[model samples]
Target: MKLKLLSITLLLTLAACKSHAPDASGPGTAIDPPIRPNPRLAAATGFDFYLLNLSWSPEYCHSHPEAAECASHSTFVLHGLWPQNKDGSYPQNCGNGPGSQTGPDASRFSDIYPEPGLLEHEWRTHGTCSGLSANDFFSAARSAYQSVKIPSQLTNLSSQTSLSPEQIAALFTQATPGLSRESIAISCGHNYLTAVAICLNKSLHPIACPAVRSCRANSVRIAPPR
Candidate 1:
């Protein structure tokens, strides 16, 4: 009788242990943690900041009249988003990923890069070094472009205008709240305003770009969009 009682107690204890055992395929099961990408690896490879290049379409179209972007009569169009070092040197062709291929869809950037060739060239030459996929890199470029506020005078010029590089930089600074003279650099070719380059941090905030050479022309002509 005692032996029978002891067996019953042991069986009950075993049953209780089995019931309390952690279930691998049931509720309350502990799941494995998800893998995460490394933060440092996800960022642009060893770049100090970004240089957002904005080309004056009228100036560009004057030389390349056949370019598709000229048809839209845009004032300021995207040139390229370049990864630059603090010393002004930049990286190019860092990888041969999807950005280097011709397959990545670029229709979404028609307003920014009206020329399809320019889109592919920029991605292969500059975006490849950005440490982001083609989509993310272009998205960043688009966002950076949209953040800048073009001055009303430049955007709505009804006639040809001329201004000093310093004056142009001042106009940009006044239009963009956080932009400053030190952060803006103007480029000119043959007395025509060609492009405006703005320096920005990884987070796309305006920053000083002392290394970029600003146009030394005393006065540069601004051609109205044709």
Candidate 2:
């Protein structure tokens, strides 16, 4: 038994020595073979995520008082807004941080990305824009659903005033020019995308005006100021 153990120990030592053995090619001068493409690395490095801020067209909403009033008051309506992409970046403005109630607000209604249902409701009730394209609206809606950011200015809006949808739409119109109620609702949809690009945050995710969302991981919750 002792001899057998000795033999086994000797074999293990030999294996260890072989593993730590120096290369005949020399030390640092040894050339390494080319690295092969790894599927795992490729997958880890490859993926697609879209994010941005949606802006509202206050000018158009203002001119159309009827619609403006409706939009302002509606709780869930996405009105008079556009996507802001001032800086070019993916997951645009995912975490823009918080805003102070003081000082001039960056377009109070600037945040407020709503869902399709609320948008349609606002159109039907305030702008008489029910005839607008649902496809375009959905494109924007889905973008918001993926993530929503409410700016601090809008937080004040929610707290200070409960304007009717029409008033809300009107307020938007007041901010813009060369736009009518009929055209504003339809055009605003496109504007939303443009606005998002403008106001996008520096991060890879969309900036939550009130809160940022990390959809692939964690989600942010922005509370409207009281």
Candidate 3:
């Protein structure tokens, strides 16, 4: 009986050892990291942000200078990225995805306003393409984005500034206001909000941004103009 037990033990140990053996496959056969288009080096091929080789070029302002001036109450500032598409040489939508517009212009809601970079924690936790509700998504976007609210008074901000998208982003980093017009552009897609929210949440305050509607509902009511 003792001999039989000892044999069983040895067999078990040997099986365990074999199961734990590492693969002897060739080097570099391990799992590789997924490749993504380099955000920095990739050409701005979409209307999402990159347009005419420039970032944050608001088309409405470029087309109607007088309206822009009235809205911002100051001369528009231009930041360099790329000029709007000229001569109609580019595709109607940027090559990145569907719904991209091509032209030498942009609307007030051209880019994702309030800038990106909020909601890092939630995004890191949930990851991309999770089946979250629109309400939850909006909340998460706000929390991650760390964006400032657009004042109700700044109606013309959309067409007022000529600053490039990159320049607009820089201004946001410094807490400068009166530049961003739309606050947030939903047509750019939810990922735009997700990306910006994550970026802002990571860059700015560690604390998440509270829900906008919830705050408004609970606060004192401001009557609309008579």
Candidate of highest lDDT: 1
Which ranges in model 3 have alpha carbons more than 4 Å from their true place? 1-128, 142-146, 149-161, 164-166, 176-226
Task: Write model 1 residue lDDT over 1-226, tens digit each, in one string.
Answer: 0112223323322221111111112101111112222233235556888888887878766656666777888898888778888875777666665445643367887877766656766676678878777867777788778878889999998889999988989888887777878788887767788778888777676788847777777888999998
> Candidate 2 — which residues are off by over 4 angstroms?
1-53, 72-140, 143-146, 158-226
The TM-score values for the models, in the order shown, are 0.78, 0.23, 0.22
Q: Across residues 1-226, which tens digit of lDDT does each residue of candidate 2 receive? A: 0122233323322221111111111001111112221222112111122122232333323333344323554322333222222232111111211111121122322343322323332223211221113333233333332233233345344422333323333443343332222221111121121111111121222222222111121111212222
Residue 134's C-alpha lDDT in candidate 2?
31
- Residue 117, model 2, lDDT: 29
- Positional deviation of residue 98's Cα in model 2 after best superposition, in angstroms: 39
On the 0 to 100 scale, the lDDT of residue 61 in model 2 is 31
What's the candidate order when arranged by decreasing TM-score? 1, 2, 3
- Better by TM-score, candidate 3 or 1: 1
TM-score of decoy 2: 0.23
Superior by lDDT: candidate 1 or candidate 2: 1
